[model samples]
Target: MTASPEQIEIALESKAWPFQEAQKLVERLKKFGNPKGYVLFETGYGPSGLPHIGTFGEVLRTTMVRHAFEFISDVPTRLIAFSDDMDGFRKVPGNLPNQDMLQQHLGLPLTQVPDPFGTHESFAHHNNDRLCKFLDSFGFDYEFKSATEAYKSGEMDVTLLCMLEHYDKIMRVILPTLGEERQKTYSPFLPICPRTGRVLQVPILERDLAAGTVTYRDEETGKLVEVPVTGGHCKAQWKADWAMRWVALGVDYEMAGKDLIESVKLSSAIARILGAQPPEGFNYELFLDENGQKISKSKGNGLSMEDWLRYGTPESLALYMFQSPRKAKKLYFDVIPKAVDDYLTSLAAFPEQEGKEKYGNPVWHIHSGTPPREELPVSFSLLLNLVSASNAHDKETLWGYISAYAPDIRAEDHPLLDKLVEYALVYYEDFVKPTKKYRAPTATEIAALEDLIRELEALPEDAAAGEFQTAVFSVGKAHHYENLRDWFRALYEILLGQQQGPRMGSFIALYGRDKTIDLIRKAIENPRV
Candidate 1:
């Protein structure tokens, strides 16, 4: 459905970061006439390693801002998923095969290096294909741009020459940031060695702006050589290349990791020197691993996109990216269940939200303002717990329990829940099962359990989860537990065999009254599992 003008106005005033970012572009359109007829949003990838969660976060976040912009203003937008394949292969990644083959190709443009996987024409092509496939799976609308093609096709010629014209000024912005030694050899351009096919970072002897060429001394042989800055013969240094990309592509908005704040500022300065406004930018916090270490694609320490999707729905992964983008969070298996539940909760709430409140909803932003109306019968967390207690080996086993809980809800009717059941089984087998530890019930806990069994016995088989909850609360209170959390903790540790679990009432209601009694009786009989 098309958003009403009133809804658009609410979106314009929305405090959500995506809307706030979209507003920046709206202001940019006002300040500088968008001569391109459309605003350009770009997310860049360096094809040195395979695509990771960080890559997904960038494109997903940029896509969110793009969607927000569409709501507020009617200006057409284009997103370019740009790859810096022309970048020199600095070092071989630790994970990929053929380390020796890759080591020999260091300093060559990534596209020029042979594919270690032997899957594509070149190393960069292999990684880029993986990236495109990953993004395609998520249905992100973007045009892929290759730095090699942009340079070789003469698309960046104008900006390449413009950088040459403002060399002294661009160097002035960059040189101060480098150490004294780096400043001595630092030129804005990195020339491709004609003989060796390596991108050489040598000091420029002279530059001819008219010819768009830089002359430099070859490190391999003590001889002067000249290469055109255009036609893929030379690529600019990191900071200069980033700035040039903005001007060359007419990028209006792009976001970077918080670690790149200084790089953004430097590149912005170079963009201004090249006579174009720098793209409106955002600095989002980086994702850390379980140990609070920053996630690196090469390090392979954090969860992969494949890993997340294997155990959780894509919407859940998207929700994880949406929340607290500027605040650091751990990206690991433990975070999956919460993210999944959060997505469901937000999605379920979208239908009832009023005007401005609707604009603030994450589901609204998640689905680009037209969130679907499907109601999830069970949360991802509850499904995980259900899988744990039943030791469900397949979706059919899970469906048996879900069918009893919501008889009208069929697997065919609720496809999302069906997928969740499959994910729950996989997650339970991989993560939950191995670490689960069941401890013996103490005398006091045994007494509480026996009382709880009696309470369940008194209640009808058709009793609601809330009714079961009240009865369980009465048992805990009657036991005179010091704190309510301790009671829940004891229940989880004893019954679920995990440190945490879904609400007992709901679990009991889904698992059935007799089965829960059996589970408790077994816990009382056996000290450990």
Candidate 2:
């Protein structure tokens, strides 16, 4: 349901990162006079390299902001996942196949480079397919548009003509920003070399506004050529291309990394120069790698989309993307477990959280409107620990422990938990296969175990969950262990053979009070952890 503007403004103010971005978007929409029909949000992809996590992050965050606009304005909205495939292949990637073949098409646009993988028409199209495939796997709602098709089909022709009409004016805005050497040869438009079929960034010999043609010397062959600034014959330089797309598409919102602050600023200026206000934009911080280096498609430092999904669920990846846009965080494999647990934990709270709190949650935005049918009986972390302890070969064994812990849940009811069981068991074997290092328990540990057994046995079976928890805590305190964390850690190490496990009381209550007593007694009687 669409919320009133006033209601959205109040809700946005409560939890926005960097505060007021959503409000600013709302205000920008209110003040916007040129276009009054629809709200258009755009995200860009440069298919020169394989799409990475940053690509995923941009689309996910853009979707979040897009949802905010939809909730507030009720305007018709479209998200364009635009690919700059017409961008020149300046360098070959280190990770991809056929580096030497890519080197052969160095100056040509990515759309012209032969596909090294041979699955698509060209290198750029292959990456584009990869991007679309990955996003489709997550069910993103977006329209994919390519620069090659946009220009060739005359979709951006009017924008190109306007840029040509204001060429000298736009050049003045961009030239000063370039270095001394670049300033000497910069032209707003990079004409595709008609002879060589390569994109040529050359000094403009002349431009005729009446003819809508630019004459330039080829960067490669030095042969002078004249081509219409419109059509597929030419494309604007990177910064100019950005401005043209905005005016052409009437975009309302977009976002980029902080490194593009200057680029965004410059593009906004050029957009106004070409007779349209720039789209409202958010400059988010970049994701860094383990070494604090900014994660790049070239560096290949961050985990691929395949790696992330293999290790965790799409919801977890979405949660990782759902954090404050301005906060720079490391995206490594180690973050997967917490992200998975966090998604499950947040989901488990949705049915219980109050009106404002429920609406304020990221999962609400992550789902666009409705949250998942959250029936997660256990977190992925706790399940992994249980899987490790039980040496669970399949879901049946894990289900035995899980059902006892959550008696009301059925194996078929919670599909997310069923999925987690599969992921958790594999993850346990690969990442958390702990050695069984049972040791002689100290007298104090033995005494604490005895007290725990006695307390659990005396508890009424119909006791509230809090009552069960209190009984366990009381036993820990009775053994002179006031720190529940320390006491719990001892129990985990002794019983589960790990440094941690699920909440002790909850685990005991679910695994059956009687079964827990037998396990603790076995440890105490054998003097073995």
Best by TM-score: 1
RMSD each, Å: 1.1, 3.2
Off by over 4 Å in 1: 1-4
Off by over 4 Å in 2: 4-10, 16-22, 34-36, 219-221, 434-472, 475-484, 493-500, 511-529
lDDT of 1 by residue, 1-529 (tens): 3357887777766688898998899899999999999999999999999889899989999999999888788889999999999999998889889999999999999999999999899999999999999999889999999999998999999999999999999988899999999988999899989999998888999999878899999776899998999998999899899999999999999999999999999999999999999999899999999999999888788998899999998889999999999999999999999998999999898888887777888888788878888886678888888888887898898899989988999989888888888888998899999999988889999999999999999999878999899988999999998797889899999998888888888889999989988888888988565
Work out the TM-score per prediction. 0.98, 0.89
Q: What tens digits encode model 2's per-residue C-alpha lDDT throughout 140-198?
A: 89999999999999999889999989988898899889999999889888889888888
- What's the lDDT for all of these models? 0.91, 0.82
